[model samples]
Target: MDVKEGDVLNYDIVVVGGGPAGSTAARFAAKEGADVLVLEKRQEIGSPVRCAEGVSLSWLEELEIDNIDSSTSRTMKGAILYSPAGNKLKITERLAGDEVGVVLERDRFDKDMARLAVKEGADFMVKTSAVGLIKEDGVVKGVEARYLGKKFEVRADLVIGADGFESQVGRWAGIYDSLKPKDIMTCFQYRLTGVNMDPDFTHFYMGSSAPGGYVWAFPKDENTANVGLGLQFSRLKGEKTPKDYLDEFIENHDDYKDGEAVDMVAGAVAVTHPPEKAIAPGIILVGDASRVVDSMTGGGIVNSLKQGKIAGEFAAEAVREGKFDEEFLQKYEKRWRDELENKLWRNYMAKETAMQLDDITFDKIIDALSNIELETVTIGAILEGVKKKYPELVEEFQNMI
Candidate 1:
């Protein structure tokens, strides 16, 4: 059932969710001469963005992405890692480059990605929510989306689900869309005004203070910053919600004692790796939709860029070759999963194991991390430390290693 030219309903690819992944895919696909349409459920491009806004310079280099003109808030030589006892480990950022990763204005960055996509001929339909998959004989052939209050059908040879953590496309495409309890981290963030935070290296504090996760303050300016806390959802059963923990943190910390919040954002970051299957007949998933975000850092910019490029190229290739079968379109999955799946899954496993430890274990673990060569710290080393000092902690973590 090849679509002939002149069908207003037809396109080479239809991408759902116009975030980083969607836009990236659309950009590259359109660059490669495919007809691409991007659907965004939101009215604005980067409003309500949920991110810590930190990315390694290596990420930019790896993707060969040029940095757009943006103001420099701060430059860091490295990160300052803190222990429960308030011990500090100053790790250098040389691994990335002479310059550590910059805390980007994520909204502007997103708009740039979208702009590039649009310039590459990606059409956009904001306020458009994809309602269901348009299936033709069990083969995914496009989608049914709601725009402004009307239903529309779009037919394409390939469909990409770049939707966020709560992705419906993956579920509709027959993939396991449910997140494991251990694979989700709850986050609460604020843009605090009047806080005197050092606009240098990002700070990472760990302990029962933020059990199963950490707290960070990414300086947006001298008097304002994006400060946030994250704790694995499982860690909050008998403890505070992420928002409550953040309040406690701000109340206790001297720098933010009287900080006034200018903005607040709450969300979840998927710690899971890419789904086992990245594609089905005529369909693919990328970014949070594919669970490609980092479990530890909760960062998705780099991974999203990689996944988007792969999806776009592969979608065009699949459509051109007329190989809409799952086997043929599964290359994107293989590429992304190969590049990051191991790291993401391993981090998730270690996080789950680490989350079970009580306060004392966490304190001791931090102490070990504090004195060790922090820059090269690996999960295996931590696991060994737990086994040696707190032998009882080994049982819960043996499966993880």
Candidate 2:
């Protein structure tokens, strides 16, 4: 099974991208007896990381991922959400497991995930970019790719597209891959040291500074944090970019003003309505490539990782049964949707409603939420409380609850 340069290789399953989702899919598929191979466009598995590196502990536990301590930076207990006028609403882990997740050493986390996939008998190729699909009679058969400037073909019975938000695989397969500007969040983040803040809580600022989105301050350690902001591109009314807003925010905040900036990153996150289909004959999309990110939270690592496991398991099953058509691959869509699509859709609608709220409405929400115990809070309960004070607004959100 050695893959030499300029030689055509074959695998039972070929996963494009070596991110968490790709690695997870490769691992599970290989474990189920498929000859799997992963192609990462980058020279290294996890270089130039583009994430905030935060994830929920409960889901990680559910995934049964081991050796997590190697990549864990800090464990959070809860979150503190601030209104436009700065009113605070605190929520503990008891009510929100994701709010109390851990900050990760993202590079290490990715590398470890890929390593695990290799241990499960999956082959990996870095500096390998999948340029196009290998199709026969209108069905995907594999990928046309390049490695270290040499082009080659990889034939596989199944293809898993974990190539991220701007997924070429999804596009090449004739699936709808374009996202409206309103559905995309332009973000800028700075990893800073010497910032003094509580390491146990993640801070969120909701207001016009980042219209239709929020600013986040996630602690990596006691004196270091990832300070960033994400704003819906459609709501960007003027010339100022997310970077400008973030700089202004840091200047106004006492704790972050003097912090030493260690690194900076910029990217766009797809928060659009989920596609009607993430699968086609002989292929399936996973992770950001599938746009599984929660619109409200702008987070997808957990969902993406979970879907990777689902897709991998199903791919192996399909290969074993000699079924690789859309009808069979559709089951992969069904299983993941059953597990996460409902919640993702709900959150997307909720985010739409929240984005339209005025500053006053947010303040009212914070006030109402303050009156309730965090442990007893749910979407319905919070909306019910809001009804007592703002019936019209609550009515509009009733469907969301």
What is each predicted model's overall lDDT from 0 to 1? 0.77, 0.87
Q: What is the lDDT of residue 217 in candidate 1?
A: 84
lDDT of 1 by residue, 57-79 (tens): 66555554676446234555667
* Top candidate, metric TM-score: 2
At residue 26, what lDDT does model 2 achieve?
Answer: 92
Indicate the residue-level lDDT of 81 in model 2.
82
Model 2 CA lDDT for position 152: 88
Clash count of each predicted structure: 0, 0
List residue ranges in candidate 2 displaced over 4 A: 1-5, 97-99
**TM-score of each candidate structure, all chains considered together:** 0.88, 0.96
lDDT of 2 by residue, 1-401 (tens): 33556788989999999999999999899889999999999988878888887777767666658648898988888888888888988888787855468888888999998988888899999999999999899878999989878888999989899999878999988777578888999999999899976778888888876888888989998999999999999988788999999999899888788898899989989997788999989989999999999898899888888999998899999999989998888899899999989888888888888888888888888877877664545677778877776787797887766
Best by lDDT: 2
